[model samples]
Every structure is written in C-alpha cells, then in structure tokens.
Target: MGCAISGLAAKAEFGERNTGDDAAAPAAAAYLREDQIQMIKESWKVIRDDIAKVGIIMFVRLFETHPECKDVFFLFRDVEDLERLRSSRELRAHGLRVMSFIEKSVARLDQLERLDALALELGKSHYHYNAPPKYYSVRT
Candidate 1:
C-alpha cells in the first residue's frame, strides 16, 4: 500500500476534481482535524506494533520451517537476515533507529511520507532471496 501522504498528494494532483462544495476545500482539509490526527496516531501505534510483531514471528517461523535460511541470517543474505547480521552494537543502534521511526510515524501517521520509502528499501533488501512469492503465503 502507498504511504498516506504520497497517496493523498497523488490523488489531489491527478484525480478528477470535485465539482461541489467539496471542491472548495483544500485537498488536505480532510486530514487537518485534531481528532483525525489523534485517531491516526492511535491507529499507527497499533499498526507499527502489529507489523513489527508479525515480521518477527514470520522471520522466526521461516527459519524454523527452512533451516537453510540460518546461514543466510548469519551472512545478511537477505532482508530477513538483517536482525542477525548486525553486530551487537550495530543491532542496538539499528533497533533504536527503527523504534524512533515507528514512534515518529505513530505520532504523525497522517503525514505518512516515509512509508513508501521504507517499503521500497525492504523490497530491495529482499530481492536477492530466491524463494517463490507464494512462500510467504504459507502461514505457520
């Protein structure tokens, strides 16, 4: 899915124009309410936690199901191995970085400008893995 900001901007820029009172409102107007912002922040906390938990669980399960991936983990052979590849110090730093991003994103979920960038980076990092796309579909 697209980031919230980029998705909104793209829609405002290229989508068909509204033809009524809605047309007079700014494209971002829908996102400016304090309540909406709060909601987004709350939602983001849930989203961030859910995604992180799901990611970790999935990684562990993948390795359990296919022990060959253990070597990949030690070698940073793919995105799934990032957690294992870093040194203790590097892992600490990376953890902090990830937490900071998640906190910031949760604080300002309505302004989701970096999500797409994050997704792209993840996709690139995972590209070297030869597993079929369907491999991700098999749940533990």
Candidate 2:
C-alpha cells in the first residue's frame, strides 16, 4: 500500500501551466499541473484549517489539564519571544506552520517517515525536560 501510494503520487500530474513569458517556465512546468491539482489543493486547505482549529483547542485543553507543562514552554520564553507568540497574528502563523506539517503527514499516511521524525523530535525534547518515556503511561 505504501509503495502504491508513493508511486501514484509520483506519477500524478498537478497540471500547472506557464504563459511562456519567462525562461524558467519550462522547468517549472515539469511538476505543475493545472487541472487535477484542485482536488489536492482543496483537500489540503480543508485539512490544514481543521488541524489548526483542533490544535488550538487541544493546546488550551492540555494546558488546562496539565498546568505543569506550561512551565516547559515558559522555560524557553524570553519576554519578547513570549509577547510575540501571544499575539493573534503570530499565534495563527505558528498554528498554520504546525498544521501544514500535520497535513503533509496525513497526506502521506501510508508512510512512516513523518511519524518517525515526530517521535524522534518528541523524544529529544523530552530528554531536555528529564522526562522519562514512562511518564506518558503514568499520565494516561
């Protein structure tokens, strides 16, 4: 299944067209499809928005449920950085960045590459807090 999806994605032409005004247009035409691309574009937009909403809700709920974790985030915060992240625009941009990564992961659900990377990052971050993996089981 994984191979099949990868193969399909590789072959799928996301029809984007060029008006031939630029010299680089020919190179850009290779991966750009104009017609069937709408499905992918719309699907990603929906998934990204949904993930952003869910991520915000979960972040709030998580902070509420485990107030202790707030200290972890605060540890990395400078006054300016904290204030920047607290702004609505900055927060939304951060959310969208995270959501885009998540949307790509979901789109490649047949592969474990993103999942492994996510786990590795989490493990590394956990080490910084001196958190044992067993703490997750305890929380659950």
Give the TM-score (vs. native) of candidate 1. Answer: 0.32
- Candidate 2, 25-129: lDDT as tens digits: 322113334433445656777656577665555545555676555454543223233333444454455566666666655444434565446545755776886
Kindly list the per-residue Cα lDDT of model 1 for residues 47-132, writing each as its tens digit.
Answer: 56555454455445555577665554443335354445333344344445555565664554454456435544645665675534
Off by over 4 Å in 1: 2-72, 75-87, 128-140
Candidate 1 deviation (Cα RMSD):
9.9
* Shift in Å, residue 37, candidate 1: 6.3
Best by TM-score, which number? Answer: 2
TM-score of each: 0.32, 0.39
Among the numbered candidates, top lDDT falls to 1
- Model 2 scores worst on lDDT over the 10 consecutive residues at 1-10
Provide the overall lDDT of each model, using Cα atoms, as 2-decimal numbers. Answer: 0.48, 0.47
